[model samples]
Target: MSQPNPSTTPFKAEQTFLAYNQTQAKAYVHGRPDYDRKLYDAVLQYHTSTNGQTDTVVDLGCGPGNVARALAPHFTHALGLDPSPGMVESARAQGGVSATSEPIRYELSTAEDFGCHLSPPVADHSVDLIVAANAAHWFDMDRFWATAARVLKPGGSVIVWTTGELRCHPDMPNCAAIQTALDHMQNTELMPYFNPGNILVRTRYAGLVLPWQLETPVPEFDQKTFVHRNWDVGEGFDNELPEVDLDRYETIMDTASMVTRWREAHPEKVGTEEDYVRRCRRTIERLLNEAGVEKGQEKIKGVMQGAMLILKRV
Candidate 1:
């Protein structure tokens, strides 16, 4: 038989889904939530307050292009870059458009050197604002910062954010039990699937290297303007904050890259009692039963801690 295509391979250890096939991309697009308005406002206020232009915006590591779609209204031109071809295709199928009815473009590219090669040939130092929502931690910071310095105009800004571990809301019935179940589901059961990038996210990017920390420091970025912000659970960072039905919660958790890895690693267990998601549901359901949550009224809400880092180009 011909050698199996590497791109089609399953669960081979990778930094992060190196090849997000179409099915996986579609699942990601469906499962991920939009960033809350407060989150968007924080980024907008920082850039606008700093006199950053809004002509163009670039979203690096733009999985499924949600960030581009959400921020396109603020900029005349918006572009989303991701290394995965399946992700690019999945984004295009959304038909994302800007406030002026311009199409939001998604291109196949990596975070480190995306700006270096655009089909329309974006000029150096022309980009106004660059963002990487729930991304950035996976980037080669040295190359990414160098690329950011090259493409960002003077006073241009960059915003990056990521959500960390999820915790059950204290107000939920049998909340302690719920929390225990969630902790085991993520911290124990899924621990083996996590990669370095996932660990960076867990630390809320505190461990992420900045431009100045790199071996060859990129000096064009202004360290003085750098701002790091953290949001606790129920602080406008989580998607299903106040409440969400059990089904929606399942979908969101299933979208996690680690969950994908777990699924790939245990393909035979998928849809069975041994499946990670199924085990999670079983555990959560039993916990909910303690509170008499009714036969089918099961629901949950969580406080997911998150962090954001922002800096400006000199």
Candidate 2:
């Protein structure tokens, strides 16, 4: 089954990662937290329930191939695709492999075209599952769904998910004040860097186009087979960072793509007093200090709220 969209509309802004250098790519890999096993379990359960195979899986927009690596152990062939050459290199360097120890392949491609655009194009209807993790907002959904329909075998699955807003844990010292500081950074300092992709994620994917919701609608996927799931704080997939010093806190915040863009647009402000991350660090440090969590480790705890959308090919 497949779906198609006519006269597709796309997001206005391109991702900053597409221009990443090796240094930036490594930093991105370092900053990102690996998703939990539970989330993978959920995906697998949903995929297999519809009689989807564990033969070949393709990860689109796979940065550093994190999601691809996670699911690789279950499939015979695990292919990760991203448009960024740097990201592809990083993913390859990270060592991809399947459950049988067969090396996974990471290629330079975009979600809009994926594996089918390589030197040797992937055969049509050869893929068993296609997934994107926190990366779909940057896609031209109409094109992506069309390509997905072309590559996916009948009864295959498409699972896309993202971690959304950060919620400071109540147990953290001066949690409310810390939350306020975090909000200030996002709503103020990083406001100008907000792109359509960021807005989609922040809104819990409200604006993300679904397989069946395209302008022309894809008949291969049925709306009845769609499943939406929300995970609150403590769900593990929210990517909680429990108690961290100022350095760790800043590093984690800097990992955000929005923050990366903010730094790029204001390189002069980076590491200077005007730096958004520096200001947020100071505010959080002050609040933690006021709570007696002086210049040390694990001063606060927070979680990323998340949402998942599952679609089964008919």
Candidate 3:
């Protein structure tokens, strides 16, 4: 049977992520940013020093195995788990990119139901670190935390992170007009289609309800071990590097989950899955041309605010 929709409220047992398919997976692989290497280094260092183990990592909601592959070198084994089979397939196809001795294995499983379906189930207190990159908002947090409590080794860590909305700054004439157009399109067209999970991301996950913080506190979890931080330096923080290329930025916009859903909902309206994307692209190019940004010379500096939540098992 097909998994239930994860979009619904109060998350039933049947709930599943159905929005992502092979096409979306391909777009995701191409458009998603490679998470900063510095973040991974710091997380690994902290995990090894605090937990005394760096042997295994389980990447939950691992779309295309990006995080798992990036981190495999530091661990003896890495597993990338996701609810979508198409995503898992894409991840496997993209394998062999890691320079590590360990290979990242991709599996079709949700964060809540992961260990239950494995042949040799993940043992209690076995996983050294658990991570969810740009995909934690969809989780049924209560169930996920319960699973984390069961699988995490003593002092093992859980690191969840997501990149937030983009803020554009173009170093061209009429910069204010360009920024205004971009903001209008994002706020008016794109924001309407975003799913409820986006609320968690917008709030930087600070408003998320953690199981350990529930009335009674989740057993086996250390309430005192939780930490959350917003790591994004904002738009003007990095000036040395060249700004985001407009073409690449457009491709990234196509990967938004809401855009995918909107495309599905309006198949007859356009040729592709993203009608708004076409419109936005056209609007951007038109505004750039009006502002005298020569063809193939348009660039805009932008930064996505990123947030992280770190926790440990007692």
Candidate 3 lDDT, tens digit per residue, 1-314? 12222333465332224456777688778887777667787678767877547778889988788788878877777888988877888889887432356567888888988657887877888898999987788887777888888888888888888776766544555667767887787677667666557656766776666766655457786667677877766332122243667677767777777766676678875554346777766666777778788887766666567788888888
TM-score leader: 2
For 65-102, candidate 2 gives per-residue lDDT tens digits of 88999899999999999888888999999977998899
Model 2: CA > 4 A from native: 1-10, 238-241
lDDT of 2 at 239: 44
Model with the higher TM-score, candidate 1 or 2: 2
- List candidate 3 stretches off by more than 4 Å: 1-9, 12-19, 96-102, 170-175, 234-242, 271-274
Clashes of 2: 5
